[model samples]
Target chain A: MATIKEVAELAGVTPTTVSNVLRDRGRVGTATRERVLNAVAAKGYRPNLNARALVERRAPTLALMLGCITNPFYPEFTLQTNNAARRHGRFLLVCNTDYEPDGGSGFLAEVAGSLSDGVLVANTGSLQVDELKSIQATGTPVVISVWEFPDVDPGIPCVAFDSHKAGYIATDHLLDLGHSRIGALVGSEKNGIHGGRYKGFCDALRARKVKHLKTDARFGTDSYQGGFDAALDLLTSTPDLTAIFVSNDLPALGALNAAASLGFNVPEDLSIVGITNIELTSQSRPALTTVAIPTAEMAEKSVDLLIKLASNDPDAPAMVRTADPVLIKRASTAAPKSRATK
Target chain B: MATIKEVAELAGVTPTTVSNVLRDRGRVGTATRERVLNAVAAKGYRPNLNARALVERRAPTLALMLGCITNPFYPEFTLQTNNAARRHGRFLLVCNTDYEPDGGSGFLAEVAGSLSDGVLVANTGSLQVDELKSIQATGTPVVISVWEFPDVDPGIPCVAFDSHKAGYIATDHLLDLGHSRIGALVGSEKNGIHGGRYKGFCDALRARKVKHLKTDARFGTDSYQGGFDAALDLLTSTPDLTAIFVSNDLPALGALNAAASLGFNVPEDLSIVGITNIELTSQSRPALTTVAIPTAEMAEKSVDLLIKLASNDPDAPAMVRTADPVLIKRASTAAPKSRATK
Candidate 1:
């Protein structure tokens, strides 16, 4: 067994240089790097990485959990968050929760002891409180995005979109377009954020003195297919409805397809407003009207939150950061056509 | 210092139970688990993760490097590969190169000495050879997906699609549809696989005795916006071409949008064929006719290869596994109609 000093002496470098090269910290010239590596091998220098890691109290990584990677909106979110993580000199461990109860739990169990310093649940309504607690008990900090635990206080930080405000804006836009009859495409109860969005939708209608129809609100998974099915269900059950406000953009695209299939022209026969404003919204046949949740800004803010959680006072009061949502007027919304002659 | 035997004695469990709890291995009874944890904490037992990791000769993690995470094609790839990795009890560390030279180098440098057991470069045309070599020298196995070093062999394993065959198939599809004037959209040269695909494009035209007009082929980055600009350039410069074959789906999508903005109806006015039938292809305004590279199959195969490289044989000969591509006929392509009389 040899010491760091011995390896450095043999490699013709200072102990600090050898340590830095071993840690891969500072810039070491290629030649110097090779010499240090060779000397480390020759000297059988095996540093206790676990001991070092315990002392450092960080893993230079962050865990990001999303609903599903294939959902176009998530790809944008992932790229931005990953870029932000890299800029902060950290790597991102992305987990696809598939919005399943088991998906989040199984992944948490898998990474129990070996997790990075902090976790960022980038998607809303994916993780249950118990699942999050399992992760939190491991001593890794958790910062949730978009959705918060409604019933249980998980005692963690959060970055959220003003979902209720977005919902009101979307509904109000349709209302201004002379659409008195509106339908809601809401996700399941599992998604905590949808509660606020749905509430806002109802509140907007109440404010306008419009009666709320239970049949107008359809709940399902957060997917394009889900949105498509919800739209079909709503259109068939509530024939008088002239507008629909979808919770997210992926399903909103599905609703657009549904409208096309149902022999109705978007904006002319039916108006659609969605949230998230993903890239495809602009390129869709009718071009979707959406509420833009600035994913890049959210990712940046969430990364900043994770850094603070990892480095600052561990007992600091949990902070909730809110990102404003903007309404992007596109080709999809308009006043419904006058009723056909009876 | 507390030994495993001492901790187990106080917890009323076997020493193996204490060790398993410390290693975060196979499940133990809840009561036993709690007792073991409490005893370890009370007795101040600290197992060395470095010693365990060294003895295991691997970490239960994989490094997956992609050109960009925002590309819709990669989200599908990442999800499938990540699922496969999870099933095998390994997690993935995702790295986004962003098609920049420094991005890959900085990441490789950052993760030095603390790398996962295996690496998967999931995108092509992004990183240079030196960047890959720097990662390879870390003593962890490297497996490049859909890209390889052209000038310098990085002496690593690879999984690639037959891009040449895919190019020929896409071009041949257009030729069989009675189109003589066809244009091509080639991605950047930095993507190692593009060269083969481009060569195949030329060879197909040559086989058909179509004149190899230098103006017919165009190169650009493999992105929707990149494809958009390239299509705009080609459509503006070449007025008589009936169809275009794009090397990737992202750019092909751009081509679709560009054609729409230029007032050309897809399939009816300008038949377009793309590669990598991404999830959005089927849902696009005109369903895209694409060369479907079985990304899921590729991911599964690559994961298996990585497992082997990480375990069974560190010294095994570097192997290249090729996945075949298929042509998916969709609404975006059709026979060119004879010109309407002015």
Candidate 2:
């Protein structure tokens, strides 16, 4: 209800000085700044960010396009990204693309350059690379973050971690427990979104000269129920398995419950490991063993890179590599009971 | 990168006509509208939302201040709110105020009537009512959504739900199943955020003439770990208790796992009932039985109320009440074993 003119009149300063004081731009004396702030408080004058954004040719927020917020992983990623954006005095406009009919094409078209200054695509697996490239072409900086494979470039500025290594670490943890008869439950197809992790699982088996039959692996949807059904089918058909390596944690949690329902005692009858140690991993029964990826680092770096790109910084690199994933040995894994007893 | 002028020139129409077509306002011939849309697509012109907002004196976004985005409940609430806001052609600016020292006072000050046209306060329990009133006084519509106690108004526009009824139904379910030794786990103090639910629980016991003691109730934080710790303590202290009434779903989940860790089989050794049937309730082992709150309805009503208030509609009611909570019976609750055997 209060205007800048009233605040300026009360503070005994020009409107430009009030603007500078509010925006924290230009050199105003400390006393002048305090007076202006006090006047603003007294009048309850709120700055119009939309007008400022128009004059500055920059929006005050960055858009984060995520597949699904309720999936648990995106919430963690969204929180970190929200905090990182806040540190820069910017807000995060989160767009859930899972419910979109065109897989967010319409959302990207309307939001790429208007509602937000930059766009951060958190779910690159489902979104097309060409769609991201087209958005980048519109001069609204676009950054693909949490990209699974470091080797595969989307031809856009992105932050990537070693997915292959993440898979390798989770599988190696299972192997270290002398689990010769192993099974694999991949959330995605053999060469779909989780290809790198599945590849890493195979390499871990090959490195130890362990034979993996065609029936030893199952590929299905990348979700908890997917993991549950796949694990149920795999365990029922191959009851001799001592360990199972799951590509993602959500499905692995489902598999854990599925295993329990099937009368299998975890860490005694079977050992299971998962990638990406989300918060729920620690809360589940037996405390899932998993590989902890650099979720926070990736989110922070993605925001940093998007800001740089939006500012037209030529020094912004095409790819930002984060720390490698490491194994967190929780209670869900142990040596095979037959070998332990022997 | 293209401007409206270029699109107008290509469409053989004035810039004003182009604007009318793009905004779906005023009158334009169907053939002319198609031509303008074709030109817009061909030229890749993006209407600046900030400029449009400045001209209309209404920002194209709404600010949603939530306690934490990482909390599973917030994500579900946020997704529904986002979809509802989208239907109104507005974007959502989510602010996670859990990390803030003042619990979002600063967020409210900067975001209200500036970056966003209206503000939706999702977590009213922890926020100060006076702070909300101050924002409302500034000519910005502020809606307090998901208010637990419908009887107590915060002197602002809000959407209310029957928390007392939710608690009563959950307690009644247990009482009907022949469980007399029921312990209560409150996610807050006796008169804190969950007070309404606790009261319902007490009233339910009194109506049935079932004796309850101060030692039978434990008050603590509203989270999984909070529920876990309290349940562990309660179960250890009162091993004869055959059922538990939890104030919220998240804490109830933690209590369920805690019971498992203590070697108590759910529904067989103890029946547990929680308010709020969140998605995880069905996903958890034994599929927790809970009272289903009208989450989606509340979110939609809150957004609708905020929009109406922003438009200065005189007929907008002070309070909007959603549908009542209902019981969702699942594997987690059953009659006491002693009664079942008889």
Candidate 3:
């Protein structure tokens, strides 16, 4: 509970001298520095972090605003961001918005009020541009991850994967396997990625001359349970469908389970593909053939960009780095059976 | 970047008066308060958070320390903890330790030097007691989650699940199903939960008069690959074993897949049970029968306890709260076939 003034008084030096010694900045005589250090130790002094942040004009911390921690995808992102933050000698404060609108707004407010040097905002599909702008208005540099707002001012940087391309690749793969009737197990349309991926799917089908591509699109929760429910509904509604493209790995896993329980053999009677090749997908039975986004790379690059912005270098170009998604073909995808080929 | 003095001058008040208004403490005339608020709005003055934290003598944020975010279990815990923290008007800063000997000590130093009110530490499996003590000495109240240091001072509160009981329940259930030649697929011995669970399994076998209890334990990474390797080793060492109890769900799933690939039928030829009943367990090929911990409840209660301690309540008792593990009997466990049953 010792104050900087108290430490200064004990060291027989001005507060500025004590501050400089603590920060390892501005020169202080060796003897004076030793006296300050001894006084600090003697008084059990803890540096006043808030006062230090004000003097340095930097919080030396970053905020990572995630959509939901439970979403498996985020842990990888968190690890990468933390590692990158450490490389720059900065700390990260994580906030989970839980995909709730109110929670997202409240979190934005709290983080904007905190002394965070920058923010890496990973939208959970629901972002209000105005809300984001207000936070940026506080002079905290922000790097948007996963989801991007098209209308965001050029000043805001974004690091994302090409969800539309991912969707196109997944669907095109199924089409190449000679399956004409494919179903889409898309997530909630409220999600920006979901919408983009769905649009991509539609575009691929249209370009392939596959008329009346029976769409079994349904909106459900963004979870395995939601995927299970959606799969069941899709199968019941479009029993002739031979292949399915899910929005994410979790739901794709759920679809696989649903197929098994319904007595359909994976890759023989039905084919499934998912996005975000999470670790579980590789470990899953009949390993998922999905698009693997470079989660670590995205996090690392986002942090690097945020740090550059925080350094107050106006010449740093505003960037939108998009890593291409790699299609990992595993045991889950195979040629459609002859009976369903036409 | 208007300073507090500038805002005060605009509001025609002393800097101290403006600070009090910002803190929402001390009596101020209603008209003066409105004037200060209007000045803050007009000048777009954002209070320096570090200065505010210093003045308040408490940072309105909590730190969450975990082993690794890549582990699905930690994210689930984080989700619940974040929700609970939000309900109590607090923010969380999550840090990963990667289960090293340093055990998040480096992260703790950064947090201790930041605007954090308290810390919730978990999964410091390899860290010695003294290392944790050093963190506590920094004057931040810490609530150890998921792991318990029995030798440490009892005054340090901990929220832990009874791993031994969970082990006993899982192994005992397999025993009651008439499986005698049970093999244990435990985690690294360095992990307290792994050791505790192994001990409990051993005790259960002794009580049941079960012989040839193959303890094919392995020390490796705490991950699915580790479990898969352990399972392969266990199968090679004890080909006659009828059932297995894994320390965690991820590894249990890995073991299940390994058994399947080895052409062993689940529950018919071998039964598998795991702890932490994670989401993947239920979604696995054959839903895993495992022990379920009340993660959200534990997080909520721990935060409640920390809030009380932070309020400077001398009467608050240091306590250990345990949540009972429930046996979620699923399709993964059953009586071994007559040929395998002893």
Candidate 4:
């Protein structure tokens, strides 16, 4: 119920100063801006929307699409992306593409006309990139995250994690543990970004002169159940393997569960490592050892790119930005026990 | 990039039928509506926003504010809400209130002018209801979730889980296992909605004629670390307790970790139960025993109410809709063993 005049009075500033601060128009000193913001918060002042629209033309709104919102990795990604987008002065419109046939193409078709100034698309499942293109075709800018465009349309910019290096590092860590027979839980989807990790795993084996055994790997969905089944199969079918590199943490946790069910203690009998160290990884039973994707970095860069593209000419170099990954050591990983222990 | 004409052509219907189906207008048969929707998806048809805006006086958009987007309990809620809103012909705009200084008051200040037709507020922290009131004062309808409108304004409708029942059930389960000496980890915020659970826990204990121990409960932020620290403190200070009821699942997982580090075994030495059956509970060290709230149902009803309110009168009965909770028996809970067995 507080007015601009009351906020101005509380901050000891003129009403014009308060108005200017609210509109982000006039050059206000940092201290004065902070004071005005504090007073606004204390008074719980909301500017009249109609008046705001007249003052601030073209409401700057951006839509963010998470193709698989159910994936544990996305909630954090969305939190960071939403925060970053807000910091850049854009109100975010989030859409969950889960359960949508053709990876949200239907919803996009339904609402694409009213979408904000730009769109940020995350989790570019196989069917998503084209849907994004259709959105862009509607004259809105689109920023793709967590995947390569794979096409030379130069239609949109993208920001993604370095999954290839993630795979290499996880393999290196297991190799350093003095394990020659290592298994991997390859992603169920052949087109998944996790395939980068599989590639890296294969290269690391080649570099270390460790023979790659195709039979030592199992492929399934990127779910805990899939990981559980894959790990169970890998451990049972390839009994000599001492360490396992999982595609992502969800499956890694599943693999750990499989190890437990099979009477094999983690780190003591088998070493497991995963990628995308989601929040759950740190709190999992044994606390999974995994590769941590720089999701926040990707989020910020993608939002920045989309915002920049929205403001400038349509042809603002549609570049791709990549963020590095980190290795987090937790209890699930340790030097494998003596070869005889297996 | 498929056109409305293309969808109509594919579905063997006139473009008006396709348009009517898209806009949820006119008397369209169910079978015809499905055929048009299928054609729309197959053709990837996106309606033109400017044309639709000119056709319909109101721009049917709904804004959903999540006061705590990082709570692990919200992603699924958001997904369900977004889908339901879409089904009601409303585009959902989501905002995360986590990092906002005034619990989303600041963000509301900036975009309050450009927000959608109606507002759906969830997981409201302290400063939110007033902000919602301020928003409603803009002649906008607002639907609150998970909190009482602390004021006498009779402000808006709310849909919340039956937390009291959850608390009572979790406690009664533990008591059924003959756990006379039980501890609890309550949420830190005195005004938090989770307080309902604490009240229920007490009522159940009192009903069983068990004297409540004030010192047996610890309060902390609803997070894993908070639960861990509180449970650790409780275990170190009150070692005789055989059961613990945590207000939320994140903290319950933390409590499990605390018991493990304290050299006590779960289900055998101690039992722990948590609320908000998050996905991690099933995958936790010992899958967590939890009170499963009907989040999807709450989401469906809240969105339905919000859309209806947006279309109907704002004063159309500010009803409180509460969904029931279910108990999920997981590995983290079990009857305590006799000292003789150990």
**Of the candidates shown, which would achieve the greatest DockQ relative to the real structure?**
2
User: Chain A TM-score for each candidate, in the given order?
Assistant: 0.81, 0.98, 0.82, 0.82
Give TM per candidate: 0.84, 0.98, 0.87, 0.86
- At residue B297, what lDDT does model 3 achieve? 75
Tens-place lDDT per residue, model 4, A1-342, is 678999999999998999889878888999999999999889977665434432443335777777666678888888888888878877777777766655677666554454466777886664456667767776677888665323334355777566778889999999987888899887754445667778888899899999977788777648888899888888888877889988888888899989998988888889999998798888776888998888888888888888777777665556655657788988987777884455
| Displacement of the residue A39 alpha carbon in candidate 4, Å | 15
For residues B53-140, what per-residue lDDT tens digits would candidate 4 score against the true structure?
4255344567778866667778778888878887776777778886876777766545444456677777666555667777777656
Error of 4 at A138 (Å): 3.0
Ranking by lDDT: 2, 3, 4, 1
**What is the per-residue lDDT of model 1 for residues A223-338, given as tens digits with 9 covering 90 to 100?**
88898888987888887888898988888888888887888888888999998789888877688999887788888888888787778666644655456778899999987786
Binned by DockQ into CAPRI classes (incorrect, acceptable, medium, high), candidate 1 is acceptable
| Candidate 4 or 3, higher TM-score | 3
Candidate 2 lands at a TM-score of 0.98
Ranking by DockQ: 2, 3, 4, 1
After TM-score superposition, the amount by which residue B225's alpha carbon in candidate 3 deviates from its true location, in angstroms, is 1.3
- The RMSD (Cα, Å) of candidate 1 is 5.4
Winning candidate number (lDDT): 2
Candidate 3 residue lDDT tens string, A154-197: 34677766777888888889888887888888776735458767
Quote fnat for model 1: 0.44
